[model samples]
Target chain A: MNQTTETSPRPLSARIGGGILLTAAIAIAVEASTFEVAFLTDPVGPKALPLLVAAILAAGGLAQLFRPDIDVAWPESAVLTRMAGAAGSFVGYAVVLPYVGFFLSTTAVVTALSLLYGGPPLKGTLAAAALSGALWLLFVSVLGLPLPIGDLWMR
Target chain B: MDALTHLISGFAIALQPLNLGLAFVGVFVGTFVGMLPGIGPINAIAILIPVTFAAGLPPESALILLTGIYYGSQYGNSISTILLNVPGTASAVVTAIDGHAMTKAGRGGPALAMSAIASFFGGTVSIFALVLFAPVLAGWAIRFGPAEYFALMVFAFSALSSFSGGSLMRGLAATAFGLFLATVGLDPNSAIPRFTFGSLQLLDGMDFVVVTIGLFAVSEVIQLLEDTEGGQAAAVGYGRVMISAKEFAETGWTMVRGSVIGFLVGVLPGAGGTIASFLAYSTEERINGANGTFGEGDIRGVAAPEAANNAAANGAMIPLLTLGVPGSGTTAVLLGAMLGLGVTPGPLLITEQPDLFWGLAASMYIGNIFLLMLNLPLVGFFVKALTLPRWFLIPGVAALAFVAVYAVNGSSFDLVMMTGFGVVGYLMRKFSFPLAPVILGLVLGPLMEKSLRRAMALSGGDWRILFDSPIAITLWVLALASLLAPALIARKGVPAE
Candidate 1:
């Protein structure tokens, strides 16, 4: 069902998203066409699926471009900052995990996320440390899945 | 007779101490995760996949645990819905209407009791139906050629995209995106790297666990952070969760109808517990007409949706186990887990690996019993768990997710990819794009492509071969019809959502 009563112009965000999707679809098609096969493979080669996917994406993009739904209400800047912080902490955790080890890096990222969710510093860090330790025990000591022990320490 | 014999031997395996213990843990953790806001069965199951893989359990045991979480969550979802007016999952959304109304009227105990009983009834009925129907469907599908399978997958995509409760275009776009993700890394037929972007790790293809955790769990953490208005803790004093004989008698028929509707709807690709519960609630509302207090604390209102959703949860397993096709996102995750366990489910699974099939079926019965016992008497303990501070809980979940993603390939690169998908997932949610179809597309994409290529190869590249067989033609028609069904339903003023 149409959410709005009157026909409103397509939202700028939807148009931009659609344009990106369309461009990606063309790019996929072009890339797929260049997939050269050395010998005679199956009747439908690897490119068939990608080309089909490109066509479907193009159709979706064209639909969005012509008739976009209502504009999404993006979160306020404060909330956005928190989300970005959380995402950044996750990326940072990945980057530092090998250097700082699982326990330290996991605790840091979890504490960072906790603070973003309004937890106090002292308690958040404690909880994060406890959680990270417990996970290490479970994954390493119990299940015996090998997690990184920090290249810094290993060296 | 053969099915009964298999089920008997299955019970022998299910009753083993190890399988039973895992079943208990599965339902217990399932209830806990399902009752919490923002953490659903999908996240719990996804996060546990790596652990299950590491544990090196038999395929049957793994399936038992994962499917326990699948159905057990249905029972747990109503706990928060009734007590806090917060639905634990989308399937529980309808339950909140009557369930919370009952709570407001000081009848929360009876409401919770009715929900448990209804869930138990619906679950048991659907499991029986699953036992009876799976074999018949598998036998029928045994004749299906690649063309038929290709068409069936198309039907699944169309049904999911149309029924995912959004504009069809966005759903299609999401599905395309998932399929595109599936096409990443090395192509299955050829060794060509299609979209690896010159990365070494990309050679293995995009792992479903990585994508699932990122899109569902990681995005969930981000979304929860955006909402500053934290939910207030629910009161635990709801008296004993027991219903009167009269109340049970009144809801007996309601539970039956809901179970039937839920099971039938769950068998179809795309529609799951959410739609099943809605249909059951509306049907009961219409049947009651003027005399019914459908929305305002009616006991039947509580019974109808709870039963339907639980039954629908169990009903979803039939396709997953028998057809190797998942009808909903949760089942899609289950299918992925099944694949990871080195068990391929299809028509032959019943005949070939009867132990796995029957063992799972038997464990479901045990799992449902565990759910009833846990929900009926020990629900207070669970309600107290709802008071777990969001700060501790959310980050804990995130850490678990982090471990699971890292465990996928033991590479930090996956972690980076996970964060990227998380942002994309958040943006998709903001724009009202459904995420389930994306998973469905990702899980089913490879199979669909293989089927298409096989079918085309058989016909020497003739496209019309796709429509050659009667079954293939029928599936094509069904796919086209499903795509148009939502539009027609909307035109008739039916609230499809």
Candidate 2:
């Protein structure tokens, strides 16, 4: 039985997608189970939409589970690296934004992404800096939109 | 006559210097952004919403600018489709077929010119239709109760889900996820928290600007990076930008027919430019089958889809202006922008904000004129943009997207959420899930919930009140019909023209 389990292979992504969805459905249903209103805002309360969403999700998930398998075409390893690196840069930009401010963080991220996109490093840096500077002038200086000037720099 | 008077005043407002300048900038930017391969109309409009808001322009001006981006995109969409054989937006997919064929045949210039002319024809003709039909629909929709609004929104969700993507189940899942996201903030009625998981940042709910930029723009950047190894495109110069007089006369009727077909389909709850262009091209082919070259480098081939798609873009506005419901993903984002601008679009919208409605209608005509002027002499200039390296183009857009998302709340938390949503969006796109329905579900979810609850409360907890009215019943029927529509369309094999 253990050998068969090892040989059965991981289920199709349909099953995994379905499993994740089903998990969300059960979680929402359980969470809605705990929703208590002090006064009935309405007879149905705020529970109705969430319940309806859970129902739709469960139906879709169940259909995927029972339906014929469809495999996800995962990106190749090299391509995966590029995608991960690009996505990570965006997340990293968000974390560093408060500490380093808009212009520096934006310029750095853009330059790295530009280089990854295969531009020459020096040209990419110049272009990234110009674009970031222009956007900062537009947003902060001209448009008067408040952007963080970096807490570290302030201190 | 009443419409004429309204239109005249609309022109008066649109002609104002600031509004006119904004309109021009909108179309110009719309064209420039739409010329980029991965950046379509939805991304262009989504990326600009925060900027327009941060600038503190009037709601009407913002609407004008955004809508200009909406329709002007059709004019620009054909450029890349013809040049690269890669449609910039989904609606231009059909345009790519005969358009690229024309380019390969060395008739790219004539094909582009025909597309521009057809787009202009579709744009001008549909503005008149919008001017005529919007008021009528608004007047009729004034009688809708809360129950009816809920049913109508359901119809919209079903329609977009069924039409926009490959599988019905995937679209619905994306929609369910969007509705779940919509439920993240405080429960409006009882003032209870939901799905927030004890974070103050989630309390005010997901901002559409942040969500949209993350979904449309950020996902696009990731998608582009997956294929970064491709070499640069060789510059394809469209030789000359003039359609022969004889060719224009030949395809004149083709343009008119496509415009009419596109306009009517676009007004329907779920149908947008994709179906409209397909229907228009197939119909024109059938009509011209006697001696015509459709799949070849036929000028009429380029004319039909271009005309249909542009007309459909304008036609989609009718429901939005009249009933306050947007039919497609792009318009759903527009609806969110309008809501953020504090403009509640509904039956009272025309009467209450006549300036907004009429001025938008007027500016569209003016925008179309500018589009023709811009696309005609400057085809070479725009096509040269196709040669721009991905590294330069992709990162610039990503930076713009980052700024837009950050500008929304001035919080790094929103930026993190935006990045998370970007990853989610990237996964969704890979899985062939339709992103539009998700946006529609999020933007309309609260309103649908509110209406459902209000109706239930009004009827003292009887859920049957949702189906009690004839109008609500009709809408419920439409919703069910649209859900069954794709299967039926597939069964019939995409309709024989």
Candidate 3:
């Protein structure tokens, strides 16, 4: 549906994605080549699948590079910033989870995401806290799966 | 008679309190998530995989719950399509054309009722067909040697790549990336690690759960964020979810035809519900010719695609259960869950795990009944849930995803990796790459590699063994044909899209 006319230039994003894929294929092939084995355990060995994958990736990358798609609708900068913020919170939650404990870190991340999605601060925090407590009860108390107690609290 | 007897015994398992309760939960949750935008059954199943594992349910019970979600979502997807004009998944896309048109004409209630009935009809028909055909297919598949299995996997990869609704090259690339990820961790044949990069965490390879959640659920979250403008609130009142007898008469034959078409298409690798529904809709349109209101809110229009997709969902289970090769993304995830539950689905699965096989079949019947009841009398409740603010709903889904990803191995590092994948998945979506092929390749790659190496080992490194057998050759031909057919169709100017 988003076909480009023959005269129109291809989207830069498509070409960039193609180049990256091509580079990845080369990297995969190079890494696969180094996989040496002293004994013949199987006729194909470990490298076959990866090499095959590399070849497929190379073919796809070349095709994309030569003939790129017409249009790719990237999000606006503001939307991108929100996405980055959400991604940042996810990474931060993982990094600090062991120290901050599941309840606190989960609440923080959810609240952060809620704000990004445009919730009122008080309502978002309340909902985040409620969700965090519910998850803790379900996973830790009921399911018997351990959630980190936070070294900060344990200490 | 043998299948019937086994099915009866399966009802005993399906009727058990725990299994029955799980089936209900699965369908209920499936409907809720499926009706909602941005959280399709794939995300729901992926997020629940770790939770299901943690709960320690038996393999059959876990499967009943998971498969209930699979088909239940098919029924639920139509609700949003009819109500909000938002088709939840690709399969539901065709439904919106007529479904939303009916809603605009104040016939939304009848449309919803028609969707429920048609879904029920389609689901039951396909399940019956599944029971009849699966055992027969399994009986034949049991004779497949390693070479045949290798060819079958290749066919799956090729068919999925070709039919995944984009350029074949992009689909192939996605499949290759998934295969590359599968090659990470320890090489089972050799003691060497191929792509671990010296990390202890990489030794286990990519946990399909983490990868799936990241690719589907988390990426969905970021993608949803792209459209920060809140969606239009669904209209609260539909007179009542009921269809007149005249309407049913108009749609009865349509449903039967749709179910048959859907089941056949669904049995093929990669075709799945989207194509099945499209084919069914076009067929009905052609049949109606000048006499049909078709896209302008005809009841048959609503019935056709809904019936076809629901039937296709069940039809997909045949290949997954019999051959242990899933044709679509959702079924592929189900296969991953089955493996995680210690159930190896193959030709022997029916004989060895009758309860798992037959019980699943029986529970589908119950799940369909539950979906009907939920969609009909309680349709208002789900529509009400549509009005919930995005801030509360989306964050809630994100939180659930985080817990699910974290629960997989209980390591925070996986959470980080999930974020990385989420970003990658977002880019892939932006670039028009298909995500299903990636999951298919990741799930099937190891088995594909194992079958290939085993075939070669048996033949003492003879490359020709891959094409030596008739079955293998047939499968190879099918794979090649699937790849080439699309190109040929496009050349004919028939508008394959």
Candidate 4:
């Protein structure tokens, strides 16, 4: 039950403001290009929307840059590192999935993530392998998801 | 009487063996997911939508199941609130106040029973309200033009921003962010690429499901990692799921009053369950006065808020189904689902698609009955699931999410995109921006832009026509007022984040 409170006595506020400004700037830039591309198409095409969105984003970004509020708590660096690892593992699963096959890669990635998330080493590894294999069977074998069954294994 | 006739026909459709079964499944699974800490109704619906599409179920049946879960979770959310003191949705927060007190007082079983009864009463009453009000609103909405639609969308964003909690600027910023994401992909009208950034996948624009899963599910995983100690609730120790007759007598009127007040409040923009429950509970307290036990395990306390929350849930649907505008994160996800299903909900919806409208309305009644029956007798089964180990549960969910993303296009590339968005979602949560508005913007942005352009085209590019109709003017005024009024009220100091 994480309550959405702004005035908690925490030091994560300025950091959040900086992040918002950065994200908003990027959003505005990306949307501005959308506006340009829309104009290049038909005069009344989807360009108007991107342009409108971009303007709003730019305004929000400027507001954040000028007056960023402080109202968040930064988790410990270790926690962030583990989260980063989890993200990386998923990305890795996606990249190596087709080539290495669903079972092996999914097992590897899930285990790696579980370990990073503080699962006991033995339990994490076993749980990841079993969970990944079970998922493959359910979605692929039962539900028919067309998952890659590993060319290496087939060969 | 008219509603009864349509409802009878709807029952005929809902009772069809296939739809009836799907309704059961929807409520069952919805209750399970809703009971699980961190996994709310929205996530459950989004993740399962792809499965329904793959199953190729008929639209009504698909909707029956999904919408069943939507209402069913209203009953289930209270379980955690009463048993574990964890309110999965904002509505359940009120339930936890009196419910936890009852649990501590060793009347947990009675409290749980009262919640189920209150939820059922509120849901039944609200469904009646929906049937009576929806058609009336739809009839009047038939005359709405594109300008009016655009104004309505503005009202939606303005309302959400004002009520999104913490910071108005942050909420506006989140909405703006969502609109930007919506702009990604080929221009629907011109067939020209806009913001594809040379990536082919970008041509289809960002999928709402992908964003939803990332923002709600994956980000939840990241948040949980920060607190690796799993949720541990105090065990329930009540003797039986039976409320005293005296308790029922005291709470019956409170439940009725809460339903009426909550339904009305929920109909307004920017008034979410938080406001609805607060108003209902406070009103009940005031009405009861000295005779009423306002806080010390008052049965009415449980009934009032529980009824109001459920009614507010149904009330929130008015704008979503009839006006294509959502007042909260959960309804925003629903709007996304409708769009994904190729169902455009707007003023013309009722007239153009009576079956979808009336069928959905009828199915809601079925869903409510199913939810009550499911929660009442089968409570023990749901509580057993609470013992599931986090190791198995968390990884299983992640794997399912992976499959869902892959199912979207049957591509690993989508998984990559999902992971990236997951990171972005986690960051957004880490920051203080509201995620619901982003989903709202992404879903509604294209439609809003389309309406704006169409309005201009019809008016020969005359901007003044945007303010022509009284309805449209009123909507615009409300939208502006929603944005400015909150800031004016909180003149103490602006939120920093």
- State the TM-score of the second chain for every model: 0.98, 0.97, 0.98, 0.94
**Once superposed on the true structure, which residue ranges of model 4 sit more than 4 Å away at CA?**
A1-16, A19-23, A26-47, A120-130, B289-296, B485-497
Q: Cα RMSD for candidate 3? A: 2.3
Backbone clash pairs for candidate 1 read: none
lDDT of 4: 0.76
TM-score leaderboard ranking: 3, 1, 2, 4
Worst 10 residues of 2 chain B by lDDT: B224-233
TM-score-better candidate, 2 vs 3: 3
lDDT, model 2, position A145: 92
TM (B chain), model 4: 0.94
**Residue-wise lDDT of candidate 2 within B210-236, one digit each (tens)?**
888888788888877767744345787
Best by lDDT: 3
Ranking by lDDT: 3, 1, 2, 4
Q: Looking at every candidate separately, what fraction of the true A–B Cα contacts under 8 Å does it contain?
A: 0.73, 0.77, 0.76, 0.48
Error of 2 at B280 (Å): 0.3
Worst 10 residues of 4 chain B by lDDT: B488-497
What TM-score would each prediction reach against the true structure? 0.96, 0.96, 0.97, 0.91
Residue A68 of model 4 has an lDDT of: 59
Model 3 residue runs over 4 Å out of place are A1-10, B492-497
lDDT per residue (tens digit) for residues A60-115 in model 1:
78776777764766666777889999999999999999998998999999999888
Say which candidate scores most in DockQ.
3
Give the Cα-based TM-score of candidate 3 against the true structure.
0.97
